[model samples]
Target chain A: MELYDLELSGNCYKVRLLAALAGIDLTLKPVDFLAGDHKRSPVIDLNPWGELPVLVDGGTVLRDSQAILVYLASAYAGHAWWPDAPAAQGDVMQWLSVASNEIHYGPNSARLVDKFGYDLDKATTLQISERILGLIDQHLQSNEWLAMGRPTIAECAVYPYIAVAGEGGIDLTPYQNINQWMARIKALPGYISMPGVA
Target chain B: MELYDLELSGNCYKVRLLAALAGIDLTLKPVDFLAGDHKRSPVIDLNPWGELPVLVDGGTVLRDSQAILVYLASAYAGHAWWPDAPAAQGDVMQWLSVASNEIHYGPNSARLVDKFGYDLDKATTLQISERILGLIDQHLQSNEWLAMGRPTIAECAVYPYIAVAGEGGIDLTPYQNINQWMARIKALPGYISMPGVA
Candidate 1:
């Protein structure tokens, strides 16, 4: 498998982290994002959305971090990372939606603004981050994992942005449950670390 | 199964439309979204995110439209709407991410701003809509469905927002392929229509 990766992107890191945790060997093909390579041919040909973390496995080419996580979990890790049952799948999927929507627009956008100088409202992004982080903290109060009783793709989908939220000027100090949840994810076997995360 | 729904919400409508097409009987529980019903007890208690289209099926209370679609498709619709294979699931899931992210922020947010008096940048939302719609049109040029050869949850996830993009000041007349794609979805057996769509 070949993973088109950008080291600084949380979305790309998600695929890397999941592959590492699952012990799946993936040849890293780094993209020159700053040089606008992703928006051009090859990358654009693979994913019209011009997004990073495009996975080319045999005959299948997939994009989107959440989708890649689903592909990896289903194809490699078995039910341990992603359940097969309908209810369990739905339960896990809700968090993937949250990751794609709230987490992406919240901490991810905020990070883009602060770390990369992207033109987005920092105040709004921070507010979004706070709102989603609060909800996640509340959700984690009773449950150890985001979905199901065990670690699922939900964790892999949501962990990166929340873990590196400080770079986006969003404080994690107030979210104790979220902090513990991040700790738990780090403790998972074969866990890999990204730049912003400790 | 009971679906907590708001008729005007594209997200909620996605579930209802899918259920109708799948021939699954769903008891609709209307939520007075304008009256802050979704943010109050019952709704808020079921989904802390306070989003609409919550599905209560026996032992499972599922939130998020994409997640609910997954539940319905996996539990009832067989492999027609959502396939069982890993690569196929990934292909379908990529569009679900697009619905949750691009469609939500693009056409959905623009609609919210126009019809519901949401405080958001209309220009940005329309720009997002244009970019995604263009990509969808390009993708649809060669393929009839968003993913695979048949209509999957990808179509269900993306259809509502694009169908009603005009309400958000996004002109859809330019995208012939998207128009044809929408027509194809409407032609599907047991397909249901929502307000603002022909």
Candidate 2:
């Protein structure tokens, strides 16, 4: 299997982190995102979205990091990461939606502005980050993990950008539960880190 | 199953459309959005995000519309809607992410701003709409359905907001392929329409 990756992107790290945690073999094909290599032939042809963390396995090619996590966990990592039961799958899926919608527009967008110099609404990103991060912190107050009472791909989908939220100039010190959850995630076996994630 | 719904919400309609197509029984507990019922008890207690389309099935309570569709499809509607294979699941999931990220921020946000008086960046929504809508139109130009060459929950997840883009002041006349795809979806068995969907 091959993964079109970026060393600095939290989206790309989601895939790499999952592959590591699940012991899946992947030949990483790092895209030169700085030079706009993602918009060029191979990456653009593989994924029209021109996004990082595109996974190709045999004939299957997936674009979104959430979808890639679903594929890798279900195909190779067994039921531990992606469950077969409908309700359990739904439980895990709510967080994946959060990963795509809230996390992407919030902490990820904030980081895009601060670390990557993207011209986005920094104030709006901070507002969104506060709302979502607070919600996640509150949820963590009652639950051990994001879903299924165990660490699933929900962790893989949501943890990367959060682990590096400070790079976006958002403070995580007030979120005690989230801090504990991050510690738990870092302690997981085969856990890996990217440039931004500590 | 009881769905805490708001009739005018595309998110709520996604769940209703899936139920109609899959023959799942759901007792609609309508949330009075204009009266801020979604922010009050029952709805807020069910989903802390205070979002519409919260599906409560026995002990399983799912907040997001995509998660609800996955639950209803995989549990009651069978593999035709939400597949069993890992690769097929990934194929369907990519569209779900689009529905959550692009569709929600694009057409949905535009509708929220125009029809419901939300204070948002309309220009950004339109730009996002143009990009994602064009991509979807191009994809549909060659393929019949969104994924697996069949009408799955991807249709249920994505078709609602696009069907009602006009309410958001979006001009869909230029996208011939999207127009054709909308017609095909409307022609499906047990297809139901919400307000402004036609």
For model 2, residues A85-170, the per-residue Cα lDDT tens digits are: 99999999999999999999999999999998998889889998999999999999999999999999999999999999999998
Question: B87-196, model 1: which lDDT tens digit per residue?
Answer: 99999999999999999999999998998899998988988898999999999999999998998888889999988887888889999999999999999999998897
How accurate locally, in lDDT, is each candidate?
0.92, 0.93
Could you tell me how far off, in angstroms, the CA of residue B119 lies in candidate 2 after the best superposition? 0.8
Candidate 2 overall lDDT versus native: 0.93
- The residue pairs that clash in candidate 1, if any, are none
Chain A superposition TM-score per model:
0.98, 0.98
Best candidate, DockQ: 1
What share of the reference contacts is kept in model 1?
A: 0.86
lDDT of 1 by residue, A57-136 (tens): 99999989999999999999878888889999999999999999999999999999999999998888988888999999
Off by over 4 Å in 2: none
